[model samples]
Target: MTGNAALTTPESTAPQSPPEEPSVTVSGSPGETRRRAGALLALARFETRELLFQVQILLFFALDLVYVVLQMTLQEGMDDYPVLNQVDRATQPEPLLFAIAVLVCVNAAVLRSRKHGTTQQFDVLAMEPWRRTVAHVLSVVPYAALTALLVAAEYLWEALKPGAIGHGSLGELAIAPLTIMLAGIAGVLLARLVPSGFAPLVFVIAFYMAMVVASDAAAEGKWWGWLSPLVFPAYFPGDPVPADLLGRPAGWHAVYLLGLCAVLACVALLRSGGRTRAVKVVTAVALATTAAGVVGQLPHDKAALEAARRAASETPEKVQSCTEYDGSKYCSFPEWSGVRDDWSAVVDRVQSLAGGKAATTALTVRQRIDTSGGVEADTYIEPATTPGQVTVGTRWGGNRVPEFAVGVATVLVTGTEKSVLQDMCDARMVTIMWLVLGNDPSPAKTFQNVRLDDSTEGSGLLLTPTDGIGMTANQSTVVNELLERPHAEVAARVKEHWTELTSAATTTAQAARLLGVEQPKEAEKCGE
Candidate 1:
């Protein structure tokens, strides 16, 4: 019985079997994976809704919307036709105000658990700290997407305008949205590292100050300035270089920004105790990408670019194409080919007022810009030295049309821009002013439009995009009086005394008398 019991013990009675394994459940089973994914989705949705409800975030984004609308409707700059290449860059920084809101709010959201002493509450949750951190980072995506749409709308508003010129850059348009993403992720990273409410404020101040200093350096043409998230070259109004002349490494900058955002994200994940192999690999790749972009943007073949710029500026005739419109020649860069018709219309209107050789004289309206000092320079294009050649700029429409009309009239009256720059303290100034304003439907409005200051009766500088002429107070009064008369009547008098009126030696009183307008009693007479 003892022998039988040894052989047939209870454990071995049924069957010979291996030691029973502990109840092992596979960690990456399909059900567990599904549950994890569902949890992540739920967490991301919750965080996004939370951010959307934040009053400060909604307020700033609303401000952004209102600002964009105002820019399109009430702004004078928008009324002036845009140079597409520069317009994209010009609109890039516009979303930064909204970005600041996202940064601060997102940082606060990430630190909310720690601040409220609910850090332990997440221990029972299905999602880990890193996953929760990822959800917060992702929550910023909707705001970034919204900002992208705003930027697109702003760009399209300008690009679709009748006289928009040049080509827009896709690389440039990508910047604002990427910038939003970067800001959001940066906020999460900052909170993870510092866990302090004041961290966002400190970061914002330091970041803004750095950008200010970097912008100044960029204006000075330092290559290191490309390292900044946004590089705004000192833009002077109405100065736009051709698309090819910009030479901005916008593509690389966009890549750099994207990589930086990824690096920040992965670092945040690592800080949240994710130490995963995948996260480590992504961080390494992101760093490599950022470094490559930096190297790519460090200014290439600058000497060649400068040479090309000089050629485009000093001798545009070689690079420009000529178009014949109604007996006048309009020469412009490749981008302004469509704009020649608009220029021709202004020339036709101005030349129609001339009496002798000034009338029907074929003019060469050469589009010019100074790129030697680069686009950042506040370049004043001096008067064109070529006779019978009037100067026009890349910008058109709005006040630009009338300014161009003034240029055409000056060239027609003085025979060259060189003579227009000479001492014009003479009756010829009255005739030139009459030619510019008399044909306009609103003479006084046109007069105000062409001056630096909107003064109708003062010794002020009369402006054109390319150059300006000074007008005496007496000359202004005479021109104003002539404009008040019937167009047919004044036009006849101007035609009759065309020769004497345009003569530099002619006195203001004699020219005013010829035009049948009262002479000013003020001592500020023409030719003084």
Candidate 2:
């Protein structure tokens, strides 16, 4: 045994030694061992072909390609579907791909568990350390190549097609490889690390749930939804959305996810360590590090985020003070600037009435729900899409105040009372109606530190802040009453509507109290 210490490359050359005397195992030269390892790796690819994981990967690839084909066909035929009319081409592709990727990850987890365990087919290879590692890794090669091809074709097709990205640019496709690579790594790495089947199942289920929840909230215009970076697709076709509203930083979020996959991959590496305490310590550290990495770059910019949040809630008056001429198309309402002191009273009232979300401002959205009419009106009234038609009482570029509130409780009253108030300005109902139901005073009142029921408007509504005392009992009745009836019939039906519409200016003292006061504060012809 001592004479053969330098050793032959094969175990077949080993000599027999006494049972009591331990035999010294000969380790080959480093360079030779490396060459042998490369040979073994190449051999592992042969084993990979026989592995069931290969079949699973191929099945998924075929299915994915087929699904893509089906989707393309359906989209082409969407002209026959009413629902597809509103389907945004730029926005729809992202969610579909993300959902499929998540499912693949789940399937991989299931197969990896069965593959690594006491499966008869893999048991022979599992007994050999190097063979197991190389073979398992090689199994993922097909999936990786297929995924790369899928992404490449998607971008290439989008480019070849005319006018693919307009409202939201699909330039994000440039980063698609990074995202897909990270996601694939995460899926495979998780399956490798937690081959228990249950962990990967739980992991993917939670990941998908978070994604869906985030998407729903974003659709509703909620700010919190932006925190879930996964909701947006890596690439979409449309005009470039603003950086301010990119939801979350895709690169940073992807980094966090990749870090998680690294930790899981390390866990898989140590699984063979055999109940050692050191293995336990390694696993614990990797898990802790992973958790930290995922949330580590969590915005320390609380102040910046707060500024964004506040800017979202601000009135035009407040926004004007902060404007630095950043290349934005929408500008501030000049007259509504720097009125902090004026809002002191209004803020108190809003705090009292606000409910639901912990941050009232979150609920008090500075939204512009552009109706079909609003879109049409925007053509004739350029300002309709600008600050002029805003019901939010705030402007992105305006000097909207940091402080403001509304008296929500006071707005609801008897039909007679509401109708009486609504009639004050037959033309100006919508704005004044918004003033009462909305969260802030009009920018026109920003300087005055008061609220104004500027004017109102109405259509086939039984009763709205826009309507006057001629309250039709129901919305259908109101529409029917107006359909063929003369103006005289409508005028005769509304009671003391003019007196009620114009009374708010004289009766209500606070800007918020304009809800209680009857009338359109401004005499402008508003209803259209």
Candidate 3:
């Protein structure tokens, strides 16, 4: 008999049966072979759950659409600014990204936890071990795929934006997804093997942390910063990444993720001492991988030093042009202007000592725009809003769902308002109204029928004075400060450094309803 009828599981190399000789029936058991085949098939089906990332995929498309719209609406000659601004916005992060992550992780964890609610680990103890284990793993495939898809979509959209370079190449594409894949795989592995909600939660915090670091580095076009892969980890910079510094390519990231999946799967297989050894081996391999990654980046530092030297050789800073200036916006760094080659340490020193907001090169809101052609003078702002229905995308597909509405409208800036006391009073009133209207009905298990409470509603409408509304609980200090400052001075300061107190900027009608006051013509804008 042909012995090729073995190896029932696709991923496994183990033999399934003993072959017979010359038509003599020689087999361990047909039942065992059939069982292994079923398990392998189930595992394949389980992996197909990646299709469900459609929800995250849908959201990816939606966010990209917003990014596109923002990119498009930039005033003529302002394309580069939007892309740069987007780069910066992608850095610090807003709550929206966090919420999306939380939703994906929590939901995945919940699904995994229910199945193994009473064990150190989820015991896939069944007559058909393979099939059950596959099912358990398949459960989190959607979340993992969705997370990966969303990161990819955002990175691609950013790279494709007008004036976006470095993104057109294949090498550019793989860098970012590799990091995201690692992050998502990490989350999936944790949720799968940890058997607690905390696993996914910690994974998400780490994921966001990585993104924050990577995004910050990208904003500056610093090649060395690619190592972070911490917050917003992706290597898809629209710039040429030199070969010397590109040690950890996206392929390595994929290997890392696959290895992670293997480790997590082993957790389900480890029911006894022998299987536990497999876990140890996998853990050791993972640790070794981490060490390798660290070693790979060491040479990057040397490469950066060499590149800096070459740059200095080509364009030596002109020592003569080092004249003094007002140092207000353009500090007296004139001496270092032409002598960049020698001013290596000088450049770092001045930037460090210049102090916040007053630094020679301030990254605050500025009016300079650099693009494909040249620079321009203009201010670009994209009205990015989370629509009523938010779509999430996955590698497999996408899904659109209703969003929890959040908007903030300005009632009045303390100094800019006709009446400081009135702004405060009006803000307080509006806040109370919103709290009542926007009350969450679910926690109380009631429809949106909760009575309007002065306390909660006030909290909702009152935006920070920095933006437009709100004050209370011995509000004398704040009110007095606003009252003391001139309207023009206060308004100017407020406009330049505004932070939203209210998360949800409501419409005029919404604001009106919140205040129980007639709609004021001035408060027409969503964020007055």
Q: What CA RMSD would you report for each candidate?
A: 3.2, 16.9, 21.3
Query: In model 3, what lDDT does residue 273 have?
Result: 27
lDDT per residue, candidate 2, 134-165, as tens digits? 34444444544555466556444444443232
Ranking by lDDT: 1, 2, 3
Q: TM-score for every candidate vs. truth?
A: 0.92, 0.40, 0.37
Best candidate according to TM-score: 1
The parts of candidate 3 lying over 4 Å away from their true place are 1-172, 175-184, 187-194, 206-228, 231-290, 301-528
Candidate 2, residue 435: lDDT:
27
For candidate 2, give the lDDT of residue 431.
Answer: 22
Candidate 1 stretches with Cα past 4 Å from truth are 1-25, 77-80, 236-238, 521-528
Error of 3 at 11 (Å): 54
